[model samples]
Target chain A: MSIHTLEVLVENEPGVLARVSGLFARRAYNIDTLVVGPTSNPEVSKMVIQVNLEGHSLEQVIAQLDKLISVISIEELVEGAKKPVKDTQPDYQN
Target chain B: MATTHVPTANGTVMNGATSLVKSLEAAHVDVMFGLPGGAILPAYDPIFDSTIRHILVRHEQGAGHAATGYAQVTGRAGVCIATSGPGATNLVTPLMDAGMDSVPLVAITGQVPSAAIGTDAFQEADIRGITMPFTKHNFLVTKADDIPRAIAEAFHIATSGRPGPVLVDIAKDALQTQTTFNWPAKIELAGYNPKIVPDNQSISDAAALIAQSKKPVFYVGGGVIKANAHKELAQLVELLGAPVVTTLMARGAFPDSHPLHLGMPGMHGTVAAVTALQKADLLITLGARFDDRVTGKLSTFAVNAKVIHADIDPAEINKNKFADVPVIGDLRETITALIPALKSALAKNSQDLAPWNASMQKLKSTYPLGYTLPDDGSLSPQAVIERIGKISGTETIFTAGVGQHQMWASQFISYEHPRTWLNSGGAGTMGYGVPAAMGAKVGAPDSTVWAIDGDGCFQMTNQELVTCALNNIPIKVAIINNESLGMVRQWQTLFYEGRYSNTSLESKRVPNFPMLAEAMGCVGLSCERPEDLDATIEKAMSINDQPVVVDFRVHRDAMVWPMVAAGTSNDEIMIARATAPDWDSQEL
Candidate 1:
């Protein structure tokens, strides 16, 4: 599988991220990299997620992300980029 | 659009169109579902000219539920507007439902002008404070200028973090003030920063632990679904060769078809998944709060595993079961770091779990999900759900209320796609199906939605039927009526001293739903005979103009199986009825 970066824009409000994250959690989707911060628009924020997914499922992720009420937009930045699966694994260090 | 000044007992006040419309537009409101009343007439004028669409609702509850339905399906903040007193109070049920389900909603209520606040004047109530605990944040717009900012902030707060409903109370006077309109560009809420980021050190430490473990498993929850991290989760699972067992809310986070997918592991979880969790060496929990339903008897849950809990909410960690490694940050960030950590840590004393995997495989085959079809020609509810799944396809959304129906749905319905099945998981709220189904249908107008509810749950918020009829929203309501609160009855029959009380609705004379539906301007179908089930459901599904409620008169004594008796472990589930003639014919 190839690594892809997903930049999601969401409404800045309560439980928005939780709902978004919960979607991925229940699906057992792991994040290779994730970066979240304020956007140029104060009413919105951006989340940068990196993962390895194939064709149809990648489209599925985009469709699901768009369904979230807080999510404004979703962009697939880097796709079909091969990264060593063993080299880049999701870590929970917070 | 001009304000009309009026003299009140306490002070001077004004009511006008420009003030109310300006604030709504400033708040970026695109639509509102409500009815107009004397107390809210000033605000109605602006709504007519503004770009925002105003949907006239038959009942205040419908306005609230419709907003909830819209918000839940769109994932956008939902807005509902209503007048004071009964209008405002009518919204309470839907608001509470939204709050309980964590749906982002901004509810606007009109009050008598500031001079008459809390004096019990015709349409006056202290709605702001009354709804404070139920919302993430709330505001009372006393000044016209404050109205714009309040609306803007309401949207921001309602949609941010762990999303929930927010109320904005505007007096009729506030809707009359005219000022140079400038919407606030930014919000600054002191001590409330909803953003989350991962700490690098914690990431490194978690990576080290993963590298050290020989047998590791992932315990996922609803948070992954919220973050849209299914691909990342799949990547990690494949990379680490880890098996994942999701909680109820976490359903569909992992592809059910994936080999490493252990399915839901909890009170009602599959036997293999639960057994695997019990013997796992390392537990990597993501986004899920380990609630009692999933943990079963906590002492025996994942007893052999060392836990690494990663959740956005810090309070969730160690709230129940203690974790050896705690990662409190955005789940997306934590997973990004964990991917590399686990990859590098591979090849550290791997244990051969082929035997264990084989044993789990055997358990799955031994206690497979099963139900009996009566030879006497009785229709099985499980079969009905399976039929719906087959005809509707995986993408068609299924919304359910709490009870035996929910369990049966979860068991029989195959959810291949994410977010296609919406149910009350954390708070198993009854009366959730009809409203949530209404909301889901509103969100995805293209898809056919089903409100698969039990008779007990349907009665709780059946008032939404009028909402469905008025809006012309066509949704199917499949009521699995066993003439009793089936779950409670099951418990009473098995262990509650065999004394069933108040569980039977038969004595009350089940509502004449067919007559009620016709009165409410919708088609209604009822079937007491088992043979009529399939054809009736097909008839209900074909209707496209208004909501359809099908009351399935099921056997009262029928009970959901594979039940973990009170105080029993997940291993000791009742797969079938005790009095069944044969074990094979009894349960699967």
Candidate 2:
């Protein structure tokens, strides 16, 4: 099984973390490392979850993660690749 | 700069409880099943003035199952309410059942004040934490102003995509506090959109596979019913002329009386359906997860088939088995797209599948569903169910409690329309039949609803019959009184040297079911002899003013046949214990 790192952007709401972790536990998939923190926007939280799964199973896990109501966006981070810098400013001003 | 004092246009303020009621009204929720308690008293205070109808259930579990039944029949998200601690804890079973079956339901619970939330206060429990694993989503609302938005989002999430239960926990303080009332609050959830459109490539791939295969089978499930795609599914089935096998959750998705229908396929499924799946080369699964019950000994199940799995939930596509073509979208949309593509592909080839169709028809007649009449003059549960199927025809909806009787009803009864069958297929909850029947009656109102229950199962939650009686809902209940846990006893006899441990419920020790029904203001009847069953069933059907209960004392030794023992290959199915060659020496 290959280990993959996924970065997920989610709404800052109660039980959102439990929901993300619960999805993995229900499928009996193991999470190697999980880190959660606030994003540049106070309303959003970012989670970096690392898990070991086969190529096909990992695709299913990612699709399920994308299906969560609290999750905003998900991106797969390449191993040993540099993390992207956070952008603090909005692209368009109201 | 934003001002702190925001005044309402009408210069009126209401408590969170009133806002909650108004929010429910805005969401078009008219009925709710619940039991109130200490933490939830504030919410119930507003119910007196609201238009929402509340049916006070005997237990919290009944409320949950009733909500599920209502949701399944109405095609809308059902609403259920309960208080904190034990009340919220009791709803766990129904929530899990809805999650597994993908029924749309919303559960509202009252919580302790925000201060007492973590202090182990009286009648306080972390319901949001408890239901997080099973629910589609959950909310813990501590502010009065968040009431309307939370309620709206709860309904939206519960009814959207692959629908399941969602929970919203309201702190008591929030309900007591006054805030400006909002009738139509904006839903601010940004991450909860469900995909409805199917990928063009996947649909084309599935169409091509269907057009080319000679031995193709359409395996359908509850998703079709949930999506209300039965018409589209029927169109596809007719277009291809492929034999269809509906799973337990999909009993009514395809009309059982149709010529190409092969019935249910599982552990207790018919031999024709099971054998056909084993021989099929192309299996088109619509909204059906490859559940263990349907696929015995997974490695050897559908061994010759290449699967094309389509479902709204992406997670279900490859969770249990590999899918050569995985189409993720609504069943209605996916089927609608694949139909034209398949028609065009068939026009070019026009391959003959008559040989396969003839073979399946031969199998159907060779091993038709059958049971022998006992000469001892006792009622057979199978015969009872078959008689009910004949009398009810296609008009009545049948809900069953899990066991041998459940399997018998599935085999004997023919469902002609969608949402005509409701059972705890995934959770296998014993007491699901009574409350579900009550909920189905409430939802349909015009249709006849029957609860086919077992003696052991009837004892679990028969108190719901009181709810039916009090509410003036006329649901008929048929309890197949076998005097023992027949399914477990059959297993013990077959696998455990007939130990019969704790499975027997002697009639002497148990309360008389007919008497209990009469005491609860219902028309109660009982049948002991085989000749009395027809008359008793007719009598029960005649009483349409109130709930009726008929207890049929069936033979304890009668077992469900065409059984594939757990964890064994489907090919090793036992047609009948007496008929098997070398039955005395062969290991099960």
Candidate 3:
């Protein structure tokens, strides 16, 4: 399993976090750390999820996450979280 | 907008419940199955006066399964409703069933007041939280105005893409709160776009592989049925002239009687079909996920076959077996494109499939499906099921509960059309047959629908017969009464040294199926002898005014053959007791 981080942008709606994390729990994918909070846009939320999985399984996870209606887009944090998170976003764990 | 005073063009401002009814009407929902409780009572008020027919089922599980059945037959989202807490929780099985089988289902549930939510108040449950993993998508409606949008989106999500269950849990307070009603609500799903068109490159690659391969098999699965790609699949089959094998969930996706058909594959599949896959050089996997049941000991299955896996769901591709050419998109469009590409490829350099065709024909004709009569000389479940199919013809929609009877129904029946067979394939839910058959009848009133159930499975959700009787659904039910959980008993005998344990249902007579059927206001019949089989079946078929139940007291010793034990390789299939078919000649 390789460590990888993803930045997912989703709608600032109820149960959006559950929808994201619940997918991992159900599909038996591994998660290292996940943080979710409000973004610059009030209507959107930002999630930085770190997972320890194979490269292909990561793609599968991302593809499944992309299927959630609330999720707008996802980007792999290629540089690996040079900064933990933006100051404007709250420190939330899920 | 929350409007208590303002009036719309149609009438006075309505509550969330009334708005939901109007939205459902707009969605063209002619029938819905549901039950009412405290939180859902407010919604029942508007439904009382609406044009949409509400089918009151005895249980919420029935409502959910009924919706799935309706969706499977109608190719539309089946709608079900229930109250909060227990009522909503009861629908969990059906949600999982729809999720497993990719049936389009819209489930509307009542939640505790938004204020009472997360408080463990009376009848309060986080239905949205409970079902988040099972549903394609879900919404917890707090604002009264969100009801219409949620309904619209739920309908859209449930019926689109891969077509699975969607949940819209409405807060009780929202339903009671006054809200402006709107029609043609906008769907705002930003990240839910499913790819309908495949890349031309992948299509061309798949075509090239198919054209050059001497031994190729069309490994069909349930996605073909969900995608409604039978016409395109037929066209592709005619173009390639390859042997086709449909999976359990895909039993009716391809015509069973087609000249190149190899029957079903995997565990409990036909010898020819399984061998063809075991020996194939290329597998043209179309809309079929390589399910564990179909690909027993995945490493050993189709080991020689180069894969051309095509599916609408991206996750399914390469999830199990590696896809040599992964075609990701809606299968109808993918196959539609591949047909022409394959034609051009065939025009270039087509492999001589004559040798492969001869081998497959030899396999199919040599090891045709057959079963021996029991020593006690009772009715055979296979014969009864086959006769049911033969008499009713392909026009009849057949649904089965999970067990030996389900296997018999899948194997015995000849399916020549799509959407003609429905079963709890992925979830393998035991009580799926009766309610799904009821739903199928509601969706297709002109055709005959039969629920072929085992005695063990039938008892789980048989209470829905009362709903069928009251609603004028004339679906027939045939209970293959083997007197026990026959599948379990078979495993016990095979693996557990015949210790039996708790696998006895006391076959002689417990709760007489015929009497129970009559009690439920259905025309009940029982057939114990072979001579009475046709007469009883014909009688069941003739009854068109009310629901009918016929219990065929089949021999309890019967077991499903062509067995590949769980986690074993498909190469080790047993055609019958102590018999493995000759596989030496399968050079392909």
Candidate 4:
């Protein structure tokens, strides 16, 4: 098993967070770490989800998440990019 | 001069309730099923003068299942409405049921005012949160302005590729506020794009596999029915002259009378079908996921088979069994493309399937589906179902509750057309037959619809008889009354040493099914002797003004045979309690 991170952009609305997180649980996909924050356009939210899976499961999860109405686009970040300097991670000051 | 006809959806300024009604009208909604309560009261105000006919159901669950039934048969988005909290929560079962079976349904529920959402207000429940995992998509409309768009999107998402349930929960305040209604030019779903065309390479690869393999089986599922692709599927099946095994959800996808049809596969499936899958070398699976029930002991399931899986949903292709040649596209399109490709591939290499056909014929002749009469002399439930289907003929639509009756209905009924056989397959929910049958009758007013239910399943939603009686649905219900939870009791007899515990519902006359039917304003008839069975069913068929119920008190000892015990390999299938069919392949 290896680590993979999916950057999903979704509409900022009621139950948007629940829709994304609940999808993972429903499909029985386990998440190692998840971080959500507002984009420059306050109307859109970005969620970074990291999961440990092997074979085509990561591809399957992305395909499933893409079916949701709230989701706009999904991008897979490079594997090693996950461990940026500890302080360079997204800050929740706002 | 030519006129460009863009459908006009502009509407005058109105409250969200009227907006909701007008939006549904703009969507060309013919009928809806629902119940009204506190938070949903405003949405009901505009129904008095609306063109949409709303069937007032007895319960919210009934409304949900009724909508599901309507969607399954009609291939349209079924609409159901309910209030907040208890009403919304009650819809949980049918939502998940429709999700599993891939029915297109739109559920509209009212929520407490926006201000009271998280304050634990009376009649407040987070229904969107509860149903997210099951429904295909959902919307929580916090503003009245969002009503039209949300409703339009809900219908679009529900009926599109890989159709499933979608929910829209609007706040009461939103329904009371004023807004202008206008349908969007196009749905604004960015991430939702379903690929319909198959890649040429994939199609050619699948076609070559089919041409080269000696033993091939088309494992069809409900998607064939949903996509309206049975014609293409039948073409492919006949071209190869190979065996076909339709899953329970796909009973009518292929003609049951076809020369090469081997009935349904999985637990309680026919011996011929189970054996075809076990010994096959190529499985040309279409629109079917390798479900656990269908794949008894997956490791041993089709040990020699290589799957050529095709589905609209990519996630399903390799979720359970690995697909050697995965064709990710709509089944209708995929099959259409593969037909020509197969013809070309066969020009180069044509493998003879005579050896495989010999094996299938041996299994079919040796282990035909038949049940001996129970010692108690009560009517055999299987015989009762066959008689019901035989009398009703191929034109009629049949629905069943889950249990022995469901299995019997699948096995005995001669389904000739798509959508003729409707039942809860993936999610085996009891109490689904009556309401779904009622919905089917409403959708097809001229067609005869029958709900073959078991004694255990009938009592759960039998109250819906009042809905049918009050309306002019005129549905026929055949209660396979065994006076016990027949399926469970059968398992207890086999696995639990015949120690029947809490299995018997006790006192056949306690509820008095006939009396209950009469009280519900239906013609209640009971038949105990097999001699009177035909006449009683014929008598029930004669009535065309009101719903009729015939309680066939069957032998309690009857069990579904040609069985594969839970988690056991298909090789261990039992034709009877202790009898196993010896296959010709066993000698090979």
Per-prediction TM-score, please? 0.77, 0.94, 0.96, 0.95
Best by lDDT: 3
Per the 3 Å backbone cut-off, how many clashing residue pairs does candidate 1 have? 57
Kindly report the TM-score of the first chain in candidate 4.
Answer: 0.81
Error of 4 at B77 (Å): 1.0
Candidate 2, residue B71: Cα displacement in angstroms equals 1.2
The residue-level lDDT of candidate 2 at B378 comes to: 82
- Tell me the deviation in Å of residue B268 in model 2: 0.9
Candidate 3, which segments miss by more than 4 Å at Cα?
A80-94, B1-12
Of the two candidates 1 and 3, the one with more favorable lDDT, higher being better, is: 3
Q: Give the per-residue lDDT of model 4 (tens digit) for A3-43.
A: 88778889888788888888888789999999999999998
Clashing pairs in 4: none
Worst 10 residues of 4 chain B by lDDT: B1-10
Q: In terms of DockQ, which candidate is stronger, 3 or 4? A: 3
Native contact recovery (fnat) for each candidate is 0.00, 0.50, 0.52, 0.50
Chain B TM-score per candidate, please: 0.86, 0.96, 0.97, 0.98
Per residue, candidate 3 scores C-alpha lDDT tens digits across B70-150 of 999999999999999999999999999999999999999999999998899998988888898878988999888877778
lDDT tens digits, residues B1-588, model 2? 111222132224889888888778778898999999988889999987888999999999999999988988899988899999999999999999998899999999999998898999999888888887778888999999988778888888888788999999999999999998764434556776566878788898889888889899999989999999999999999999989999999999999999999999989887778877877898899999999888899999988899999988877877788888888888999999999999998987766878888877777776788898877878888999999888877989899998988999899998999999999999898889998888888998888999999998888888998999999889999998899988999999999999999999985247788899999989989988888878888999899999999988888889898888899987777788835323343221
Query: What lDDT is obtained when candidate 3 is compared to the true structure?
Result: 0.88
Error of 1 at B326 (Å): 2.4
